[model samples]
Target: MRRTRITAAIAAITVATAALTACGGGTATGNGGNKNPKTLTYWASNQGKNLDDDKQKLTPELQKFEKQTGIHVKLEVVGWPDLLNRILTAASSGQGPDVLNIGNTWSASLQATGALLPFDDGNLGAIGGKQRFVASALGSTGAAGKDPAAVPLYSLAYGLYYNKKLFKDAGIANPPATWSELIADGKKLTGGGKYGLAIEGANNAENIHHAYIFAKQHGGDFFDASGNPTFTSPGAVAGVKQFVDFMASDKITAAGDAEYAQNQSLEDFAKGKAGMLLWQAAGVQLAQRGMKADDWGIAPVPVQSGAPGQGTQVDTMVAGINLAVFKNTQNRDGALKFVKFMTSDEEQKILNGKYGSIPPVTSAQSDPQFSNPEQTVLRQGLAKSAVALPQVAKESQFEDVVGPALKDLFADAAAGRPVTEDSVRKRLEKAQQQMAG
Candidate 1:
């Protein structure tokens, strides 16, 4: 999942610094016109089971880089909770790692700060040209057809995970292929204190990702071509209502599940308390939680069937992290070298394999491991129907505003209170107003 921890306060801080002059163009020249710096610092995001795990896996790669480039390197693995705040502070102060990893969802937002070096034509050519990367992954780095501020390093896509045993017990021969069928299957599976679906209602990022998929399935988008917010569009409203109705209208999920975060929902599924869940490559976590390989199955998320002219299926957000170079670093050339090394096909294999995510490099994506039965469905969905979150400067604000509105609606639904389409529209309209301000 693309976890955007950006709160209103953080959004305000980013907005305040948006006007700062961007350090554009070529890498900074070395002292006295000499090139080749001796050292560089890299801020890596926490990708492994823990921070130490990340260090264990990356240290060897960094050593290889140092040996190849003669540049000493310092690596710091930042936890997700602190990474964004740390990057924002560094951007504003012009002090941070020479290179760093950023959530793909934040690419456009951070690019607007002028704190990162743009991977323009020259820089991209130095690495391997734009065509070397997957088109969908590259499309997420920044605004369309513009010089991207970052490059994709790893990739992930959501899948619908279900309990095979649960389906069999419910007399269902196959997983649901459409929303209506999912609800029907859910009704059959819900009973005897077990739920049919598990939702991360309290986690803002999780909620927004599902909301995005639902909106796209209904032929709606979060923003129009002109970058105007369209959260209250009929499609958006219908999508969100479908999400919230799991607790309200369907009654297939628990009323108290509005408090569920991503982990909690996963825990419920792992324990067999819930029959199905929508999650990203969580196979590692599921195994860690004591779930067996044969116990669960993965499939593409159900689409809105019978919608006029809509495609057969829609999947989750095109999710992953990107590597970016800070604009103010003195060792620009060294940092660029480091970025090239990290995204190299070899390094992509090592990092993505160890982390249980797909490599962004086209050649590396064909690895045998990625074709495991569990991942095959998700990879196919990504190739065909995975939608990237809207790449807008205000994307973070979109999360900050709509997340709580959805949360509140879920809370009310869970409490057996009244919820109407008008209420959903009002919440979305208020969010639009907030984005306008």
Candidate 2:
């Protein structure tokens, strides 16, 4: 999300910053230097059920780092709502943590600031070569042909989650494998006060993620080669309309979903009010909320007609967090050491296991813990079918603008207003024009 979700991408600030241009090479600032080799600061994105959980879980690890490297670490867990804004403030002022976790979707946008240390061969080699990371996980780190602004840490991919009991009760034998089947199954599950699908209609990140997949599945992309917005393109409009139709026309999603900016959809699915959910690595959230492993099952998010593939058949967005270093950090060596420690196979297994995410490190992914059915579905999708959001300097702004356009459309759909090709196109046209201005 901007699935770091829709809650991520960025917190909507009315006077949003303008789009930035990618910088050609590494740039440094004077605010950071080698003045504090024995200490480092980190801004970790909120990955646990709450901020305290993150701190409690990470404290032991930081202690280990301090013991091993003699570096005292300062840790701050920033909520998704404020993470990007805080990072942006730090980047522009050259006053930020030594290291930070960024929503993978923001890689290129943050890269353009030139405030992050790009992992060129030397930097990458300092930790482990770029070869140590999963190839697909590497896809969203930054723009193509440029040194990555960050490296993969905790990786995730969306999958369809369905209640096993609901499927049985409805006499549905299997989860839907295509759009038609999904809608059909949805109808069977829609009665008795239960709907077939749960969605985060007002979530910008979730909206953009699904819209990106739907667009590509219909054989289109949001940006051109030069990274220009093409939101009104036929495939994009059709894609968005397809998403809205799930509620407006198909009647699978509840009308109230149009106002669900929080994780109400997941909660709804967990409580058995909805039969299915489309989400990224939902096992943790569901488990914490009291849904056991046997209660639900997971499958690849449906494709148009056939199995998911690397091309237009893509089904999920490459969603996760990236570990990055600020270019001018005082303790560059200490920060890099911390990165290596975090991405280490042992740590990857421990950390990703705790967070219910797939390890981006190839070796760690082979651990038996991740071999479960749910992990298999998510790992396979991330490796074979998921597509990264456009890696552009304006990618963050795109989410800020286009995400709301869909939000409004979803609102209209919930209000019993018509959702049409023309309406979707007009909204997209406005979104694109905003990009231009």
**Candidate 2: what lDDT?**
0.86
Candidate 1: clashing pairs of residues: none
Clashes of 2: 4
lDDT by residue (271-387, candidate 1, tens digit) is: 998999888787877886899989999877888774222242466788989999876667778888888999998898888877778888998887788888876876776677777
Looking at model 2, the pairs that clash are: 2-9, 5-8, 6-205, 33-330
* lDDT per residue as tens, model 2, 1-437: 22222222333211121221133212333224335688888889888777898998789999999999999888999987678778877665455788999999999988876778999999999999999999988999999999999999999999999999999999999998899899999999998888989998898889999999999988888898899888988889889999999999999999989999867898999899999999988898888788999999999999889888877789999899999998767678888999999999989999999989999999999999999999999988987898889999889878878889999999999999999999999999988877665
Ten contiguous residues with the weakest lDDT in model 1:
25-34
After aligning candidate 1 to the native by TM-score, how far in Å is the CA of 4 from where it should be? 13
Best by lDDT: 2
Which regions in candidate 1 have their CA more than 4 angstroms from the true location? Answer: 1-36, 70-72, 306-313
RMSD of 1: 4.3
lDDT of 1 at 286: 83
| Candidate 2 local lDDT, residue 19 | 21
lDDT of each: 0.80, 0.86
How many Å off is the CA of 169 in candidate 1? 2.5
